[model samples]
Target: MEAAFRYREREGDLKAPYEHTEGPYPLGRWLSEQRRTFRAGQMDGERAAELEGLGIVWDTADAAFETNLAAARAYYRLHGTLAAPRGAAILDVQVGQWLTNVRRPGGLGQDPVRAERRAAALAAVDPDWNPAVLGWTVDWQRHYAYLAQLLDEGARLRAVTAGVTRHGEDIGRWLVTQRRDWARLNPEQQARLTALGVTPARVVRARQAPAKKRSTTTSGRGAAAFEAGVQALAQYLAREGGGTPGRSHVERLPDGSEHRTGVWLANQRQRRDRLDTGQLEALAGLGVPWAAS
Candidate 1:
């Protein structure tokens, strides 16, 4: 008991290393034996009370989990989310690897009650700490959190250009990809992004006016025309699957508007060399696989 008291006073916790000794006494091994005895309900009531009074933790694993949970909270406070990569750590705790382990099926130990408490604690730290969705990964969630932070800071979505990055992730490029693959996102994911002022790209033509600034007007018109072409291609794919259309083919959309989709597609292919990476990616995501090449 004297040796245990000395170790506890020095370490600030009862979690001593297995090889730890207090002077000539193997205090760590003795403490482990006490925990075993306590678990088996074989420890004397008086002795158990003494150890408990000294703040002895009978469950070393639980103590370790609490330590790691502190690290996770610190990480979240710093990064705004618990979507840590595989090697992320806080001080001495391998928080990222710990999160991965606990997120696994049946990884929270066999005690149902303890698991529930641990899960609740983690959720309190960050609700999406362990994403429950099938396709949601830590990397995706991390980027999303970063985007959310930028939005909260009043950053405009359109102004986040390809080079605008946060924590090594090109959020602007990611935003573009999300807009391009809007149809591929699950409803919940779409709803989340929509709530954050993100939406699928659409063609918005400027009102016709006198040629006061033809250069700026022409640039705007060109972008609107390209978006219109992309919209047509998307509609054509929805109706006709992946088959390429003939040059004379025309598609009548739900809005009762006719698009010369075949000609538009051919023109886009001809001008593929001029398309930006985002534009090409948008086309590729819409099933125009050749755009990727």
Candidate 2:
């Protein structure tokens, strides 16, 4: 069940609609079967024990579902939709005041709805009553609240998992940036980058590298080439260094005089085999420094 939850969270969109093969099971049929099984208890000791365990598990699952359903219905009754825009507005107002009380700058500084109202008044003789406009504002607030909730949950989970102080805003921003970058890249590129454990920031920084300004001097070209070579070496080291012994490994240079050089050479070789010059240069410039040789 845990594995199923993870798979749904990670790859739900990728799954085919009809991949299950079997049609949906009827809750009524399942319940009837359960009732029969419970009535036939103690017929076989192993079967009886299994049925008893299943009953407990089923009951727990049903109770959780019921609790969640009741919460959803209550929320909808109070705030119109599950999105809970009015609730979100109240939350935003509370957050703003809370920040003011703490003497810290809060997001947007004032009520977002008031800002929208002021904009509408300036643009027209009266406030806009378009259902679409009103709906959009509500939707935006709901989205904000939904995201805040997700961030809060994620922070709690991460605090437990990583045993670190919860930094919800930083983590939320990182997640948003990562998702934006992932959305920008092709699936193949995303997969390759993910496989290599490369992050979106690294990719974005590589893309934003200053254009290689042409150098007029021969020495400048040499410096550039040397820099390029150094970068290549670093990549080689990263690819080949630090692993269990007897696997692909870097041998230390004698007297450690050119240890950096040796490491760079190793890394350069690996980078050459693994990537094109353009890719290598980009990787190198993104702070993948070559070992001192």
TM per prediction: 0.54, 0.18
For candidate 1, the 10 contiguous residues with the lowest summed lDDT are: 210-219
Mind giving the per-residue lDDT tens digits that candidate 1 earns over 1-293? 99888878988877665446799998766877888788888999999999998888888677567667878888898989988876789867898888877875455777999898788888998998776332455666788899999988899887987888987879999898888778767688888999998999775679986744222212577777777777776655433323577889886655678889889889889877777666777787666768978
Tell how far residue 59 is off in model 2, in angstroms.
Answer: 41
The numbered model that scores best in TM-score is 1
Candidate 1 stretches with Cα past 4 Å from truth are: 1-48, 51-56, 203-293
**Residue pairs with backbone overlap in model 1:** none
lDDT of 2 by residue, 1-293 (tens): 23223334555521211112113533333433444565556246675555444332233333322233334434444433333322222322332222122111121126566435333422242122111222222232333333444444553322322222222223344344444446444455456445534345443334566755542322556446545544334333332221222324333332332224445445554645444444444444333444111
TM-score of 1: 0.54
RMSD of 1: 15.3
Each model's lDDT comes to 0.76, 0.35
Clashes of each: 0, 7
What are the runs in model 2 whose C-alpha is more than 4 Å off? Answer: 1-170, 176-262, 265-277, 280-293
